[model samples]
Target: MTKLTGAEIASHNSKESCWVVVHGKCYDVTEFLPEHPGGQKIILKYAGKDATKEFEPIHPSDTLDKYLPAEKHLGPVDMGTVAAEDEGVADEAEVARLERVSRMPPLSQCYNLLDFEDIARQTMRKTAWAYYSSGADDEITMRENHAAFHRLWFRPRVLVDVERVALDTTMLGSRTSVPFYITATALGKLGHPEGEVVLTRAAAAEGVIQMIPTLASCSFDEIVDARRGDQVQWLQLYVNKDREVTRKIVAHAEARGCKALWITVDAPQLGRREKDMRSKYDEQAAQVQDSDDNVDRSQGAARAISSFIDPSLSWKDVPWFRSITRMPIVLKGVQCAEDALKAAEYGVDAILLSNHGGRQLDFAKPAIEVLSEVMAALRERSLDDKMEVYIDGGVRRGTDIIKALCLGARGVGIGRPFLYAMSTYGEDGVRRAIQLLKDELEMNMRLIGANTVADLNPSMLDLRSLGLHTSIPRDHLADQAYDRLVPPGLKAKL
Candidate 1:
């Protein structure tokens, strides 16, 4: 219950006794510095100052309370006497960024999901953009996620009554307005201040489900509280190393009325996203000692927050998860048909065919491609109807959603596009993005002579070229968002 002046906290700013202000409270993090997953440098930079702005985007509000011992909670600080940190002059890069923001095209101009990415790349901060946009090394899978869709040409039917097309569909026993839901992506505050709650509100407006991430900037209750009446939300969980912690999280989510539990199975360890690593290298490398072997300096933001994920998670744990919560269990990262079969045998409610948005493994087949193989394998075993199947990654257009549905997907999940939309224009941006997809879905369904989601079939697609990995035309909008890797020596020149 102690209330200390800013100067008192400022005096203990050295490595021997460091203190930082976050959300008007003072925390003595000196002892915890060496164990920081982000490396010690970032904390040292804000050693004696207010780190609220830098802290809010990447960390949940309960982070300090959960990780730090109660003794480290040094109580509130007197903000009236706090020394105002100097606002340094903006560099040329910042000036250019501001100019781009000023010139950002109107939201009405964002005709499709790609348009949001184009604007986000030009306007977002360098670090934020890097974290959100970067995929695994070489980013081949990331590009291929969208490219694979182009290979499957649509077989539009003619002379059929297609008026009054219906886009309504049910996912995990819940009826939704559209066949696609806003999928989970971490660090929502990195793009927008309100974080996951922004997406929650947007999803409610669109009558679609929102999957809240395990590493969201906002607390779990904050996002759950943001839901409107009967607005369903699912939890995307990264199982923690501590089973007790994971169990508690599951119980709390179920108590809060979460409709499903999406257990992410792909990321045992964070993938090496070069673009994101490069963005943090300069800031982190100089702060740590070569003798200090514990800190991993190269992982950037992804590594910092994901240290607790249980790499030992396996099929054996399925029964344990079932015991914890009755919310429908979904294996979120099954890449191959074999794993898909295994998931079905385990009696999971669903399997989300994804490669973690191509962020986990480079060269991993796109989710759309995997969906075809899995659906075939499931049908062969008479297990296709046993559980719902969903796919995410590179789902941008309404046609993309149609393609997945035609191939036996109950629904599709779209992640990055919504984040990009929210990043550029807040909740309104997210609403517009969903509305655009709805428009495209209706028009495409009508064009393909499909009156309802049930009308979509594999027969409506030309599958001969779906498996071919041939050269395709360049994707200009995607290319614009991609940051080409630069050699270390050339980094300074840029």
Candidate 2:
């Protein structure tokens, strides 16, 4: 690879000819301008200079490899000859934050998932915290997602030989060390510099599956390539309005050896997340609307990028998705039994009973509450075994996993807690979180008198109060801990 002077690279900065340097390597992204997912304006901002800083945080290392042709790889640039931009003064607020964080307890002191959330809230940037922690409307469903798990009581079988419990399981036919996989969460860079790649590393090390989010800061190939050996990965697709774009994305994931395609069925339109919305609700958005570029990125992170998701996605499109890839198709946000039967009718492989972690519809039913109804509906239609079922939202403990499995869930997914862990302590935090769940599963399974996940049955759980909507006070101390960690403007309505 021939090294080019920085001056030579800078000469190609125009819409007609754009060359940007990332991590000391120059690439001619001239033809890729229109194809950029974030819109061409973002690339144009750093058109003539090193975009490493701007690109590194939001993009996976393999983004160029996945999107650019081999011919566009224009070798390296000479850093010695580069005219460095004026290093601007740091934000005073940021300095104060770093100083504050320096005085806090170390990551090792953080014991559980909720502890990680508290640490992440203190350490993360305000915008990031708002985005990760916010829920739709009054956040009733978010509270319910956690509370519903507590409603179900475990019926521990006595006098059963409970030695040697196995936490390992298969998700969508892929082997995982734990029954739970790291469910998809978007804009991971908002929490950590490495973004979703941090999750990829952690999942691989911990022997679990990682479902890569379509809106991830890291591109699909980057997450796939980050796998250690044959570690499994699943792709979570937020179908683009453009069918051609959807087709290409599906093909790419399948080609990259993704084990399954988990299409998000909710989010036809993004929910009004007050916390995220309020972050940019001030006069800045209006001021920026009149800028040279017509792009309005000020609507906070969620609204800014969610514009591309297809509102027309329907049951008809399921067949179209099936045609595009050989990977198993799973609907990610089925909230009712009727929809669960419809999913079986569509002949898809699975459905994750979820409400977008209560980030979507306010006061939506928790996945666990709907599980019994979905199972009964499937059984009536003789479709109970036709499609595998899973649940997510407020899964903090192995006991939560046990409850879902007892109710006929093939597996479970966990999202926000892992994000908080990643934000607080990076990969090590995630690794510890996974280990903690395994330890809990071992102990809980023994106490519940289940040696294997298969040993868990509906009879083993007392679900008489599961269907009730009444508030069940389980752990006020943990609730208060999370309450303190909530972002300032957003109040928990539970």
Candidate 3:
């Protein structure tokens, strides 16, 4: 039987509209109705219609012929003219999730996207929150992480009969819902009892790739299974002192269907987190043998470091990691263009720009600030064209995403915010948080008259008011980008 693609279903359900059916899934895109960064005319064409053809270029990873047929066969979307009460709707994706995740109240309530902090506070101890929430020597990077968005106030052009916006984009030759990577985090159980398992569920549902941490409580096989065989999972490796053990872990992740491997190079050693340092929290160090249900922090900070980390590491070990995996290799902590280019030289598949949530390095420029420089270099070698480039730091709004995208990131990732949401609500909370981010991204996209993330160019920005001087050169600007932007603690509210 012939079935309708998500776009066809959406078109059938709504009157006439514009929207992106990213990776064969549909989104409402109504709330982000007005703020498209692209001109209204282009967006309106997509209103109530599927923009799949528009998406193909950005998402080159999938073969169009196969996806086209599958999406159609998924089901028929009830075309227009049904009563309001009709069972009229369509379907979709995202994060890792254990089928074990609770769909009920305390669990369900935690699913809200807006309760970012509440969830973190709920699931984590005050000390854990301090450790997770606080950043660097003074948290400047933390503040800039969200504040960088203000530098680019979107310029929305009007009167073109706007209707829809497309959110699909390519990342390392793959399809994804948004141009945002589901950046990895430590100890999924810390956010919700479901831990990495629940995160995989969220990733499956949301259509974003999951970057599973090396320290995940659940085994790699467990995480892969929860993805339900419909996910693109990756590994986030922390090069440890034990090269053999580290290689083993990387090999395990690859063996378990992981498509990419992200080696975090920024912390040859962990950063000094004053917030965690000042807290009453003691670290668990490691799990009690044979017990799957409890964390023993009795050994305090000493053990926490032991269990949470593998200290002996350096860039020299990149070749060792390369020898073990056929999957894409990404470096997770490139703060500058130099590092990004270096990763390219080392034959990495991608480069993820981050400051480790200000967790590893203090006073570093927020990742967003240096995007222009990194992107310029990426573009220089055609590496940006072949390999993926990502940024993660102080990203809280769609506008921040736009700035980075304009500067040339294949995509961006959010760590603390989603982790905060997960801590509070579990899978549903993560869903909500991701949705909110998508909404914010769509809103800003519409406002600026831009359709794709790649359309976000510096020309759309008026950095002049933000104390930006064109003469200083992009390199210098990237270096000082965070200093000039307002912090999330200040006036800018996404």
Candidate 4:
């Protein structure tokens, strides 16, 4: 008994027997929950039961599909009762009907209707498809990303008048129509030739924030131009050990009106994506340029990413970056409270809570699960409101966004969902995806009796609603490097 992990003990009792079959695999989550300080309830929520309804609210939030295994573990938790509380959700049959109506084949449907894997299979070449779909090692983390969202069950409060709701919110002191933003991701061109240009422009048109990867398909100027109207542009950078390139990238973004600089630290080294290795994605990527004449220029993506990446950055380069630009500095790949505390001291304006689309590490905790731990740390250090925290990675639906906001996120980000929209249609497809999320968010807002984004608080949540546990550590945590970020004198106060 002492040897059993909370998740493992929970999994042993599941219908799948000896395995919590999520997205089709037997993961030993049993030993994992005790490591998860969030407590055992989270893992128990999905243990020995299917988590389909619990998963619906958090579908698109980047937790990875940890719930598919719950399909085998789903244990008669009465999900219909929970979903019935949401005002905006059409009849279950209606969602099915809408999804069915959305499958009118390619050109007829806008981009947002397709499922995550469907868009990848349809838009990207075989190799790109594999790269986008593949996860590290055995893909447990990839599959778990989705399943983790399933564990975060929604506890709706009915009978409150939520007729007119407010989705308006602010991030980094800037007002936003929705708490959602276009998260930074690598190699946009791989999905469609229209690439970053088509995608960011589509985001800008939607009155949202447009963020670009440092290794963008097009130059900073080109992407900014794509967002010409009122779109907000943010840039993502990887601080390679090389200092010079990092300075240049930061400077280049500020010169182009790029509002924020997001430094991604998760991929200090890349994750082992087995799918891309076997798919020979490089060879398949070459085929796009070979067939460039047939590509869609309106979408604005080049045929290859080889043309853009300038990988040379380091942690030492962060301070030097602040010296060169006034744009808000945001660290994008922070997973723990230690890093969040360090980010505050470093004079970081924000911390992007993420697991890199489950792209960098496998078997790591899901982004949604990590949100509270990071926020708790931020509050402990009194930087909760001083610095913003934006999360991304397994979010697929509007309720997922609402749940994150209630959990203390300044806002949320979506990568795969937008990419899916682009592949399914184009600008129009991407637009539909954003609007659907907005409608869902607002609808849920009204039904839940919440009037504004400010109405979201930890109080709206209940601990008994779930059973969470994981393989996270209770000790041996690292010291936060806050001293490293601030001016020398400020260190004394911390």
Candidate 5:
């Protein structure tokens, strides 16, 4: 394989014949330009240049090999002869963010998960913060996810021995240290350079399960290999339009010892995350080509990478999934009782009641609310015992976990909080976050007169105001992170 000179590669640097260097290798991406999910404009900006810095965070290491044909994999580039990409004037926002990072409170000061989020909001890059914090449309559902937990007050029992409170629980036949698992979130490298592997190591240290996302910045094998002995992992999948691609992914996950297959069912199409879209637009504005490009610029990172998800996925595909692997199948993102019952009927091992962390379907009920309804409906049909039930969305504190378990949830999934921890302080931060939850869980259990997980039941919760959609007290930390929505044509001056 001959190494290509920088001058030779630079000559093919237009829409007609584009080439770019990534990780010291050159690739002819001219044919792939139009097919690029993030749009051709981003690719054109890095044409004939080292795109490694831009590419490493958002895409998996195997992206080019998996998506691009072998013919386009040009030989290595002699980087010594390559012209260095111009580093223009420093961004003022970035300067401020760096100062904030320097002034961030020590990890010991973060007593709770929200504290990590508060710190991350002030320290992360603008695009990264926007992508992680933004929710669909008005973000009413996002706020309501945490707020709904407040609606149900606790009913503590007295005159009961609470000397030993146990938080150990099992999900899908796996015993975990706690009843919560780190749920899947995409683009881990956007927050931390090490990506999902950081969560993997943290989960291992804390003795909890980690659900690896299909869109993880680190490759699947990288996360799996990072696991300690007997550390459990589950795969969260977004079904691809190509059946073969989906099959290959499922087969690979099972072969890599993933314990469960969580099929995301709610997101046929991603919701409009305005903050992310605006952030992306701002970054790309200076790079816009003079020509009328057909690429959609309004979609942020969410839509850009999600174009391969099969919108036609239906219940009929359940049997096909079962045929592919023996791993326990879990239907993630189930929002209603009807769907939960249907999932049980389809013979899935579990159903995770979720609304995509309120990133999909703006008005969708919180997973905790949906959990209550589903449990009732399932018990009515004598199907409550048919499958393990789990819920995710706005689970910030141990009290939230208690509420779900009382409502018949086998366990809960927490996504954003852990990501915030990892973003703010890496592996140590994540471990601290888990420890804090454990501390809270034990204290809450002892107060509620529960000695073990089985001791928890619906009797421990007062559901009188559970269904009311009333406003809760203002959350200063969340409000600070939130980007308030403005009415159309009423943009406020920044």
Candidate 6:
């Protein structure tokens, strides 16, 4: 392959001859313009220039190979000949913000999950941070997800032999170093250059499962390919309105050896995430060009690509999902006991009692609060152990995992913390966070006098304070951050 000159590449800027550089490689994406999922304008915006910055957050690493032919790959560009493109007018506010972030305490100083979040907030581009942290209107449920665990007081037992503690567990039959798996969070590249691949590598190294998000900037295969051969993985799906696309996605994941399929059903429509809306995220979507086919675009970037998710997904669709693949099909967003029962009746392998991290609906009960009801409902039907139950959202510590297990949860899922860790220090941050959790689990287990995960049960917790009307102390730090991000007009309400 001949080395392409940046000067030569610069000449092909028009729609008729569009070319762009990604990671120093020049590619002729002219033919792919019309077929781009986000639309053609995004490509044209950086036509004949380096698009790596704009491209990394929303597309997979192998995106070019999947969308374009080998001949379109025009080889590496000569850096010396490349003209320095204007970065457009820089915003003074953004410049000052980046400077402030650059001076924050070193990544090594980040000592806990919350510290990672604090660093991430200081370091991440404001828009990306807002999207990752925002929940539905008022964010009551979001706060409750964390607060619920606080409400449960531990009734630790004494006189139990605690010579050595084991944090190893299993999720969907795969062994894991801890009782939690890295849950899915979308648009990871918004925080780090490597996106979900960073999570994949960290999870593999930590001996835990990483649930690949359907809306990930990196494609599903890129995440799967990043896995160590013996590492287990799961897939999180937002069913596309196009059933054929859904079928194909499911089939491909099964073929890739995914152990489970977590079908997200909470987002019939995206909730009104005010922080994201305040960011004018739609403006970013507008920059992408083609409108999403099945959803309303007025919402924001969060909804732009999500327009294709099938709102009509229902019990009837469960059978269809079962017919398509052999992997266990677990509903990812069940929020109440009744729905949890319905999920079991439908024969799903498991039900993840979640509220989409409080992103889908405002004030929806936290998954932990719903776990007791779900367990009781299952017991009534002699299905208590028939279907596995898991929870996610606001899981920041091992004690939180122990609480959920006491309520009969098979395991818990964690999403935002790992993301914040990766956003701050890449894979090392992720590994450190996992090790921190393991350390906490060991210490907590020893203090709680539980010999193993099996020893954790309902008697070990006092749930009287778990009432919805009960007052839980404010997470002052989280509240301060939330207050800072709330649009000025909405500040009065908070």
- lDDT for each candidate structure: 0.89, 0.84, 0.62, 0.62, 0.90, 0.83
Q: Which is the leading candidate under lDDT?
A: 5
Candidate 4 local lDDT, 1-494, one digit each (tens): 12223344344653234323333223445554443322344334455443333322212222333223444333323232222223365666446534543443544333223343354454345555665566777777565666666566556777877767888888876678899998875556566565778787777777888788765544556677777665678888766444566677678778877778887777655666666656544322333333323431121121121222334545565687688789888888888888788778888889888888776677677777788787777777788888888888778778778878888998998877777666546687777788888888888787666889998876666534233645545343343533332211111111
Mind sharing the TM-score for model 5? 0.93
| 242-304 per-residue lDDT for model 1 (tens digits) | 899999999999999999999999999989998988786333345543325477766767887
Ten-residue segment with the worst summed lDDT in candidate 3? 91-100
Pairs in clash, predicted candidate 5: none
Task: Give a tens-digit lDDT track for model 2, residues 1-494.
Answer: 66989889888888899999898888999998776645566677667688887676556677788679999998888977766766577588777667656655666666567777777777787778889999988999998899899899988998889878988877788878888999999889888988998999999999989999988988777678888999899999999888898899889888888999999999998887878777752223344333454555555557766878888888998998888888999999999988998899889999999999999999899999889899988888888878999999988888899999999999999999999999878899999888888888899999999989889999998989897886555797897677554322222223
- lDDT score, residue 227, model 2? 89
My TM-score estimates for the predictions, one after another, are: 0.93, 0.85, 0.65, 0.66, 0.93, 0.86
Give per-residue CA lDDT, model 5, range 188-234, as digits (tens): 99999999999999999999999999999999999999999999999
Per-candidate Cα RMSD to the true structure, in Å, reads: 5.2, 5.2, 20.3, 23.2, 5.4, 5.7
Q: Between 5 and 6, whose TM-score is larger?
A: 5
Could you tell me the lDDT of residue 381 within candidate 4?
A: 70
TM-score of model 2 (CA atoms): 0.85
lDDT of 2 at 342: 86
Q: Give the Cα error of residue 58 in candidate 4, in Å.
A: 32
At residue 336, give the lDDT of candidate 2: 94
Ranking by lDDT: 5, 1, 2, 6, 4, 3
- The digit string of per-residue lDDT tens for model 3 on 355-414 reads 887776666776766776777777877877666778887777667777778777778887
Residue-level error in angstroms, candidate 6, position 151: 1.4
Tens-place lDDT digits, model 6, residues 1-494 = 67788879889998899999998899999988776655667677788888877778767777788668999998998877777766687687678667756566655565568777877776788778888999988998898889888888999999989998887777788887788999999999888888999999999998989899998988898899999978989999999888988899899999999999999989887788888767745345554433443334345558655756778888889999999999998999998888988888899999999988888888898888899888988888899878999999999888899899888888899999998898878999999888888888888999999878888899999988887566656799998677454211101111
Model 6 error, position 416 (Å)? 0.6
Question: Which segments of candidate 5 are over 4 A away from where they belong?
Answer: 285-293, 472-494
Worst 10 residues of 1 by lDDT: 485-494
Q: Which model is ahead, 1 or 6, in terms of lDDT?
A: 1
After aligning candidate 1 to the native by TM-score, how far in Å is the CA of 364 from where it should be?
A: 0.6
